[model samples]
Target chain A: MALFTEAFLTALLAGAISAGIPLLLVGLGEQMSEKSGVLNIGIEGMMLAGAYTGFLIAWKTESMGLGFLAGAGGGMFVALFMAVLCVRLGLNQIVIGISLTLGAEGATAILHYFQFSRTYPRLPATLKWDIPFLHDIPVVGPALFGREPIVYFALFLVSVFAYLYRRTHFGLALQAAGDKPAALDSSGVDVLKVRAVAVLTTGALAGLGGAFMAIVGAGIFVPFMTHGNGFIGIVLAMLARGRPLWVLGGATLFGACLSLTTALQVAGIDIPTDVIQMLPFAAVMVVLIVLGSKANLPVSLGTAYARGER
Target chain B: MTSEMAIAPDSGENERKSRLNMRDDRLHFLIITIGPVLATLVIASFILMAMGVSPLDYYGYIFQRGMLSPSGVQATLTRMGPLLLIAASLIVCFRAGIWNLGGDAQFILGAVFVAAAGPELVAILPVWLMLLLCLSIGAAAGAVWSLVPAFLRAYQGINEIITTMMMTFLGGSLANVLVKLVFLDPETTVPQTRTLAVSDRLPRLFDTTVSSGVLLGLAAVLIVHFTMNRTAFGLRLRIVGANAKAAVHAGLPVATLTVIVFSLSAGLAGLAGAVAVLGQTGNVRADWNPAYTLTIVPLVFLARFNGFATIAFVFLFSVLSIGSESAARRLGVPNYFTLVTMATLLILMAVAEMIDQRRRKRKEV
Candidate 1:
């Protein structure tokens, strides 16, 4: 009956990974959007779209791989709206984003009510690939090394993004798209196209992250299952100061805090569970307050881009 | 007229131009406002047809039940009591160019505080005094909840969006905690605040089922519209919202105005919470969050932040919401479909707004 056993600790660490992966994927996608100055407030809606489509397809097809793909596709479909309205039409990013999220929420809820609300089909546990020596080392080993193959891909994306931001010409265009669209345009580049691509990429990434939540994390889809993970992704991206690894770190820390909350409640702490549940959100706020000032954000983050207008 | 023109050479021209502009604005407002609504209906009808539900039946049901029937009209008006207050709060903030997304959280906290305090106060105090105290508590709780995010935004240059949303999550959890732990009514097995008797709650208007909260909502929106349009303080806030840098250059208290906007909007939201509880539910339960904020965001936007237009929109929204529920029951369509309808309307509204903006820009050019 004692707490903090090897099994207990392992489960806790595993829970952290399960919770953190969606944030990682979402944060990385939001990073891409922010980098191109789109803000992409529809991250939550995109995630919901991904989750719904990902779960529906996976359940019907009985393939987690296909589910993740559908999730990405679903996210991109919603993101296309962002690309069209906010990027192409020069609409208010924040307004469209909130509306998109609400739309997605409503759309997904109705879909669920029709298809899954009555039936409530759940997928089997997600298959994980165990790394030979590393996965056997202990709690950290099993938690980190024995994750689904996508976890490794998600972790590796940080490095890839870092290199992309630092090395590529496209990266410069993306940066310029966000920071100085007029200058980027002057250089004979299509700023809108770059932004659209960035937003689409963001949608795909967010969708995939959402699919991971349903397929790997919960093995089921429910309305509002993303549960503000998309917003946290935005926060992580913002607080990371345009650094990919920092998003990983922030997501991890938030995940760790979430796990601690779960662990405390499970341990029968002599306190209200709701108070414990508030920790992660409160922690994020504290982090944002302390570091938000120092986080150098995009210059044209929320503003719509246009020709010959300030 | 000649003397007036002689005194100020362009006065006649300016007056004529303004009169013409006012007419143009009215036309533009009608096109912009009603255009998206019709578009949403058309688009949603196609989706409904695809889903095997009769679009005619759906719209017919909404029209008959929500608009035509007296009881349905009462329910819609009852629903509007809180909705209008929230809309007022949103219009205020959006006008000041701030997003007050934390309305749901502020609302819940306010309602919870009032629900906890209302029953206790009614025992000792007169009905009028108790109701007044409860309303004040609700407003105070909501304002207090927003203070932190407002300070963060005004002082530290933090985005109120993140801070306010974060506060919402925390506030929701805190509300549940307060209900379950502190205010648990011992008389009932359910975890809820002690409910006041219906007689002790907000008085019924004209001996009808509708609560007096509707009057409060109407008053609030009108007061806000007048204050924001016809007053210097509102103009200052609008200036700060329009361009903070310009306001600062002009020696306006931009930071303080920002804080005021947050509080005023949040206070209205809290007042909404109080109205809903006092006028209808009479108490809060654990995990009781209606999340009217996000839904109302589109409604306020559809109204173009104009109070009069928002009143009409809120009424339409309540009708849509109330009618959709019964229609869903009759047609076997999920109730969530109304949200789909709303989302479509919101998008179309954005498109219309975009087009309108383009037309304005071209006109300016």
Candidate 2:
């Protein structure tokens, strides 16, 4: 009711960003993958893998940084496996992606069962960073300035990706490969090599996002911890029309919806919690419906490459 | 001087000659039957070993407990009720080249509808009539839930895989909240529905835990198999699945077929849920995490979308599940070991297919 209360709005925005960070990382990664012509539907599985690996490593080693790296590494390895199937084996990409997602989920569950017997301790790993100058700049600054390191990392990556995608040759080539692989091939670039790297990079970022969820957000590894974060990322990437910078906007909106639902529940809304929980997914569905109608994606985004076509 | 140019046998001639005799008996067996049975055994063994139990002892114990004893047989049948039905439901869609991963949700919706309707219907109707209503409502609920992804794919072009999966999540959470808030039995320590009257429950077969659902599931399998192989609609479904563009060119209503097949598949899942409620659980509960929905993928994969293969795969998975529990109790191993085996076998099956594809490529070259 108190819209003018700077403190109340600040706290709300802060919490929204906290929730948004995971989606932001995932969205950025998926954007890169989609831009390069691979729809990494296995993003959720990769996130789950990251969550398990991050939790297991952090709990065992008591090193947050190492756990994060382990998560990224785990995601990269799985993404590379997917790359092998899609890029080298020429299986149906959609089926391969779905299979990879299932595989990651199955593998994570199995490995975690064997490694820790699903009994690892929850270790608090995320560090809260407070900027000296920014923290002193009144209500807004204090609210946003003091948060987890991941928030900053997510924001930084958004800027980096926006630049790389719009201004760099590598970005142009990657985008071109998605829209017209033949052109990229004719230009003497190895499309497979570029796409493989793009897919791996996407996995690493998604893994990092998932690691942030486990090590920072939850402080423990619960089963299915990723909880469709990767899918939300896909929705965000799609909603953004595969534009890297726009992914941040999409992630923020989705994140806000999630945070608002949770907040509304806490605020004792009369609606069922199930209804509230469906808001993010509903939002994504709506966004996809709108964006899919308007946006024209790359023609060859989901198609397989023929040998030496150029 | 040493020899004239030697004439080589024409490969094209060999191809033409082999065309009529193109039956690869071994490959056919691998595809149709052996693959599923082998995958099941491999997964079952992994699960047993991981539980620190010897597979031999576990299998022996399962056979003794689950197959030999009357009570054990009832237990196995009870477990098979939902799984068989779910697998059968999957067969209908998968054979038509559509994958329905929302079975978990559909199943829960059926349960929810049964819980919501059972008491009200009991006041006005006979037990059999009430049961029929519950089953039909359940199927309707499932069909409604399925319409989202079906419509999206049919018209808007959203990926059904993700959409269907998202619905599963939504359905699960919705079921949980309903169980917690609406149908909860206040006296019970955990959230669940009030137990229904015995007359309203599914009829037990010869005073055992096994209900009539097993027969119903088998009937479903037969019906679905016949529909796919013998019917005009089934033919269109197969063509559309194989190539939508070609099917459209051939004057088939691809969109209508897509929606109908999806609805049929989801309705089957819903029926599975009703069976679980009336026949197995005898009441609804929040423990709606039916792992079979996800596990069904591997089962269907092993079966290659064949109805009989689906039954065989389900039976195989059931044995493994039951055997794993026996191993855990006897050998002090964890039950999740079974899942590990199932996953490993699934990956292996995919890899095997990939290898087969490569072999074909080499043969062509």
Candidate 3:
């Protein structure tokens, strides 16, 4: 009759990881874009596009890998506009980003209406890859080590991003573009090119994250299923302050809180569901505000770079 | 001696060229402003074609239903109340160079505050007085909700966009909680606040179905426009917005202006919410978001911060929104098609602005 039974604890842990993976992917991607001086407000749109395409592809081909690829492609497709308009053409990033998200939402919803409205097909449970020794460990073992390959891949991306930021020339270039575009331009590096590449990569990673949400996290795609995850990712990236590890930590905390909400609901807690559901958002914002206040964003963030113009 | 003689003729030629440039500037401005709208319509037509709907027919139906019909016009007029207020809110923040994306949150909170307080106040006071109290409470709530982001941006240099949006998500959840648990009407099976009697609601305008809230919306827009353009306070806010560091050096109250802008913007959004409830809906429902904030954003931007222009655009937008529902159902298309069109218009506008900037830079070179 205990509320904290072993089975319940394990489910909560598993749910946390499932929720955390998409956020991690999005945070990492957003961090890269921010590093290169692009805020990427349209990432939500990219995520939605990825979710739709990823789900559609997975549903049709019955292959998760192909679905993830298609999702990334769809995200990049939306990002192409971001690169051209915000980065190349020097448009206002916020306005363009908002429009892109709205456009993507409408486009995907219409696509869904035509293709899947009647059937509303859902994907099967994703295949998990169990790590040999890790899978046998108590409560945490099955939850962390027995997730789908995408979960591990998402975890691995944290390390990959950390390495790229700390030890790579490309990372240095990205940092320079965000901090001092004029200096970077003077040094013969193409600021526009750097920003364009960063934005596109952000799109790809965000798309992959969206795909993971559709295929592994939810086992289905719904219109606007990304549901502000992209915005949460922005907050994570900002709070992380260029630290990939912090992004991982923040994402994990957020995901765990989400799982806790679900647990509370399932346990028949006598509270309004809306209040219970608000825990994750409130928790994340409070934590970030308290802990990440000193974190510094890029100086040149959200400003268009015009050569020789102050 | 020869160089001096040459300079005199070149100076005269430059004078003529400058006058020509002045004449061309007006034409360039017109192209930059209007070209994007035409482009968006053309692109949206392609999307309509892809959806197997006739663009002309859809647009025709929208015009017929939204503007030509009496009921549709009334509906459109009623819808404009929230949009115009939100547009006024946006004008304040954007003119101050502050991005207060929390209008949606402020709006929902405002509505919730009115829903919870209006019925109780109605019992104690006359209907008009009760309505005034509800509106003030809603505006106060919205302003309170916005204070955190405003303070953060003004003092800590935090970006308001992320903070405001986060607040929006939280506000939405809180609104639902208020509707379902805190202020649920026992009489109704549905999770909604206690509805006000029809007699207690805002009086209809000219005996038409349209609510008098439209007049309030127009008044708010006019006041905002005047505050942003004609007054010395407006000039000071503009100076602060133009360059905060410069304003500080000039001893202008940059921080105070920032907070004031946010309060005014959020207060207007709250007023919009109050108007929607008292003038039309009469109550709040769980998980219901009019989403008036996002819908009005493009209209505000398209108007270029001009109050009269905003009224025209809001009129057009409300017509599209109200008229498109029937057309969407008939064509088997989603009502979101209008969103697609509006979003496209916004993008095209950004692109046009970019192009205009590029051309101007090229001319300077």
Question: Which residue pairs of candidate 2 clash?
Answer: none
**Per-residue lDDT over B1-365 for candidate 2, one digit per residue giving the tens place of the 0 to 100 score:** 00000111125676575575467834564673556446756676776576566777766776777677777677777778788888878877766667577898999988888877887788899999998999899889889999988887778766665578778877888888888888887879878887777767888887676888887887887778777767886766777666667778999887888899889999989988888888877678775566467677656655556677677667766766776677667765556556555555555566666676567668868
Which parts of model 2 have CA positions greater than 4 angstroms off?
Answer: A2-11, A34-41, A91-120, A137-140, A167-169, A172-191, A261-272, A286-310, B1-28, B31-74, B94-100, B185-189, B206-208, B360-365
Off by over 4 Å in 1: A265-272, A289-295, B1-18, B363-365
Off by over 4 Å in 3: A265-270, A288-295, B1-30, B360-365
Candidate 3, residues B314-352: lDDT per residue as tens digits? 887889889988887776768978878878888887778
Residue B208 lDDT in model 3?
88
Sorted by lDDT (best first), the order is 1, 3, 2
* Candidate 1 lDDT by residue in tens digits, A1-310: 5887776677778888888999999999999999998887789999999999999999999988998999999999999999999999987676688888988988998888866666678898888899999988988899899989989999999999999999999999999998889999989999999999999999999999999988998888888899888988987887787889998988888787677766655655566668867887898787766765734667778777888775
**lDDT leader:** 1
Give each model's whole-structure lDDT. 0.86, 0.74, 0.85
lDDT of 2 by residue, A1-310 (tens): 7343565556556657767788888888888888888878778878888888877887888888888889888788878877887766654455556666766775676566666775856787467889888987776686578877767877999889888988999999889878888888888898888888888998899898888888887798776778778877876786677676778877777677666654554554556656666776776666556655534456566655666643
DockQ of each candidate relative to the true complex? 0.49, 0.27, 0.47
